[model samples]
Target chain A: MVFTETGTEIALHAGTSCSSGTCGAGIAQNPVQSLTPEDQRMLAAFRPETVEAAVKKTIETYKLFSYTDKILVACSGGKDSTVILHMLKKFGYAIEAITVNAHIGCYTDENLRNLREMCAKIDVKLHEISFRKEFGKSLCYIQSILKAKGYDYKNCHTCGVLRRYLLNKYSKPLHPDVIVTGHNLDDEAQAVMMNLFRGNLQVCARIGPKTGMVHDSKTDHNSATKKKFVQRVKPLYFVRESDVVKYSKLHNFPVYYGECPCSSDTYRREMKDMFKSFGEQRDEVKEHIIKSFISISEPLKAHFMQAEGGAIQECLICGEPSSKDICNTCALLAKLRDNKIIKS
Target chain B: MVFTETGTEIALHAGTSCSSGTCGAGIAQNPVQSLTPEDQRMLAAFRPETVEAAVKKTIETYKLFSYTDKILVACSGGKDSTVILHMLKKFGYAIEAITVNAHIGCYTDENLRNLREMCAKIDVKLHEISFRKEFGKSLCYIQSILKAKGYDYKNCHTCGVLRRYLLNKYSKPLHPDVIVTGHNLDDEAQAVMMNLFRGNLQVCARIGPKTGMVHDSKTDHNSATKKKFVQRVKPLYFVRESDVVKYSKLHNFPVYYGECPCSSDTYRREMKDMFKSFGEQRDEVKEHIIKSFISISEPLKAHFMQAEGGAIQECLICGEPSSKDICNTCALLAKLRDNKIIKS
Candidate 1:
């Protein structure tokens, strides 16, 4: 299996054997083959052509404000993020990439190196931040502590807290009018589940193309800030995950187009597999979910506005806006540092 | 620990001495007994009395609604279901217990026996439906086929689909105004996870206090000659799982309170554990989730109603409404009778 310049062919690996059991490796098996019917149907025949189309379509679809403002792209160095960075740059959005490295051993090592290499190739400015530099210890250290103390949490907890912190920290200095996240519709749907499961309605309300719960001063981390929330937008909110994969391959982006090793140990990975196993039925299901989110969001928001709960408090440790005195990230870091097991 | 005359408490387990890597099991190692107020406040106190209070409060808070019309109560003889049946009878709702016997070895046998005994003791009419009679094969037989073919589904899949069928069949004959389910908040929250993960928004939309999306004849089954949809209601929507356990104990109702042995092999159990570990934080999360569901549900419903492309089609053989030509229940039976495995 080889990929030609076009990177077209072999979309559905159904009847045939994808010995590796991964969509990326399987699809890329014979990238040189002529586009299959399924590939043609998805218009992924011209991988390079289709990716550009999706990015262009996404931009056109969202009809965002002028690209003249400072556009910051959150780069995880993964396929989706790389593709997003490339797409933004291609579309001539005044964009710069920011990567938050949690220093999670083998996981972040390859990703960070690949991201730095991509930035060098594309000649884009990249900002890097590490968890220890800001919070005093690595996430693995913190997770071990939490585990020992009987407060077992998933790795996503550490990743989420740090990533969010970095996003805010980076955005604050640059003061971008809007921050662009590589959150595709599927990612948004997943977040909807996380938010729904966590019962964090107010935070979820501000998760769409626009960001933040209310337009009140409580959400604004800085009093001198232009707006209460830093208008986070999703350019690829409507783009499919498969299309993103095609685009990454076509654009010759350096992305670790595979699931994180630890992710398989999670229930979410089970859901992801379920989604992957489901043939074509997923698009409609996702569309329904997005529309569902759109349905009660306004009423729920209004209810929140009418509620008597106080405004978001500033985290005493980090100054990030939080419902509690300490922010989630800081708390996570502290727990990690405190919980080191002296295994002799 | 000695149980009172009321059949709630019991004398603590005597002669327990074991050493697991995490914690040693001994009366001296009991944290509650060892710790003073300061140290104890830091850890969770699993008090039976507090659990009882929480359970009682949970039910009373939401049991305000008392339906005078005919109500069909779904019973599994499990702790949650039995407790619900007891509560509904106590509340004096015009209701009867309906159980679907999936015919899985000792599980369903014990379930039926326990359910029958409870109904006899409580003097309530118990309606039992068997899958072997209805579909011609036991659930255990169905499960073997699904597992052999690597269907990548849980036991809950067969049971869930079969339960819905049985509920409708029983509810239709009775012409019950509402089908009352023992779907407590925890179950609802987990369901919300399942629906979102699979992007089954229409089903989620169908999931509310009393209304579900069944208007579409192609996707949702219309079995009753009188009504197209069963007006389903949850009297225990706000009830907590811990409370349900406590309530079951307090009432001394004969129930198989332990979890379904099969649930341990499922992904949902993982989710349940994740939620359980959150402790009190779990409720805040559930409230936010309920709010989120209630938030965009209506507009999302309209979105789905407007663009709902597929419809539930009736099975050609059994004439049950199904998404495919054959209903899932029928498909299970067919699979059990034979060994061919091609997912529709």
Candidate 2:
């Protein structure tokens, strides 16, 4: 267990005082006393101070948010996002949280409860959106119908694209400066590997600390035009997933621990497993991969971006920003509708 | 077992009447009748027809060697090089073989014996180089002394650099147009991964099918100079190591199957294992990685080569063309001599 100098000072300053557990800025309540030696070491390495330091570094490096900016954290009641939300609040940042409830039965209810509990504890506002309310069908039903039609789409893929579409669509009204995500180093590294494996070098432009451009067909494609993209930020972009898990456990947040029921064998999962196994041998492999990716991403973008000279266009069906006439989300929905699975 | 349309014709034309087992042109006797079904399948995929087609394609793509040029096969009595030597011979190309006897006890004897037998059968000239004759001590002696000095250099690393240095140095008198190596897809892909892990993008320029430009310090660094590098080529660049093994065994080549006595765990070996594991899930992963490597090699070369404008220098000690004043081999030898591990 290692602690930064500041972390050690905080631990020493708060020796068994402040029972509310909020006084020790980044020091936990010595939860190490109850854990096995191995787990204790793991938890100690993930001390709030270390994780917080990484988050702070990422935020500063990417210029994620300012105190005056409206920061909207896309909370899924998962350990990553929950930790991010808690850390931002601890840092005295003005932040709001939003959760898209796909209404996956009891799981959805539990996730909502977790979000509400954390929001109440931090005295922050929580916004809940439902798939049925926004799209008139549960995600489970949509996936099932698509599967029955032999569409053979992955549930996580469908869920992720639709969820991002909803988050972006709904956040426009909120007028937030940035949409913060809980993407950690493991997630980002896995995503980079996935893109490499799929030979999608152009997609690398959408990675990095602060990425995703607003390619609005409604406006001129000229650089002078002010882009309206609500830049997404990942404060936990440098922290490892294991560290986040340890931090979550140390804080004892009521975040949902269950995996999504629709999640199954996937390429992402395979890459994640490969990374974890490699991590066991070389601790900095994930960091190295991400570093290598960043070094080449710009050059790769320069080489590939020129090939993609076509300006963004509006999806004919949904009138959303897209490279093609139909947005990816609308295309999937169209497939579902063609099979009489859903109505507009 | 699968058979290429042309492969079956080649196999049938030879029949079982070739007493010396050398009459069949790139066709092996049906040893499949005695093997297990799985082994049969493996060997079927390594059919000489497929391997030959790959060789032909690589030669055409890289313009490796012409009919009039002399070719040197750097055969370490290994399966890859022996197979290459035989394949080129079967194709009616004028070829010579060279083996480096590093004097690692019985292993060296066996390697030399295998080379002699193959050379005798094919009636190709074989050149044997000895470490003790050239360097005044066996490789084992220098490595042991270096290990005592706490240098802790890997045996394979030392052997590889020294062998390449000797090959390039000795082949000058013969004036071979191209030095052919037995590197297959597996070796190339593993090398690419190793470079990525080390964050050595500059080293990537020395990769690909036909790589390594001779930059003479005495001449202009510009491209017009017709640099006097004996270009290296890998005819089996697209074949997998496993397929090479199968091909070697199917033809009953008396190649030494033993690994180098001092082989150590390395990043390359780890990558090879990773690739093999992935191969279990997707057989085309090795091919994909090689393709990915080739796609980026040019861009990587363009980005890095300009930064390396310094022309190759004559090694002050050995008078060989090198990137530095003193070549890598001379540097190692200097260290050995400094430690009294070698004598002038």
Query: Which has the greatest TM-score?
Result: 2
Query: What docking grade does candidate 2 earn?
Result: acceptable
Candidate no. 1 TM-score: 0.57
Candidate 1 residues lying further than 4 Å off, grouped into runs, are A1-48, A65-81, A92-120, A125-190, A210-224, A227-232, A236-344, B1-72, B89-106, B127-179, B206-231, B242-253, B256-344
Please list all clashing residue pairs in model 2, or write none if there are none. Answer: none
Overall local distance difference test of candidate 2? 0.69
Cα lDDT for residue B35, model 2? Answer: 55
DockQ, per model, reads 0.21, 0.26
TM-scores of chain B, in order? 0.67, 0.78
Q: Give the clash count for each candidate.
A: 24, 0
**Share of reference contacts kept by candidate 2:** 0.11
**Could you tell me the lDDT of residue A296 within candidate 1?**
51
What is the Å distance of residue A63 in model 1 from its true position?
2.0
Model 1 lDDT per residue over A1-344, tens place: 22234433222222333322442322233344534566456554545665577567756665553667888888888887888888778777788888887655555656787789889988889999887566554555555545657877787776676577567866778887677778787777666655565656555544555553224564444444334347667777767777787676655567666675445456455445434544576666555666556655654454454452533445566544455677676777666556532111
Q: What TM-score would each prediction reach against the true structure?
A: 0.57, 0.78
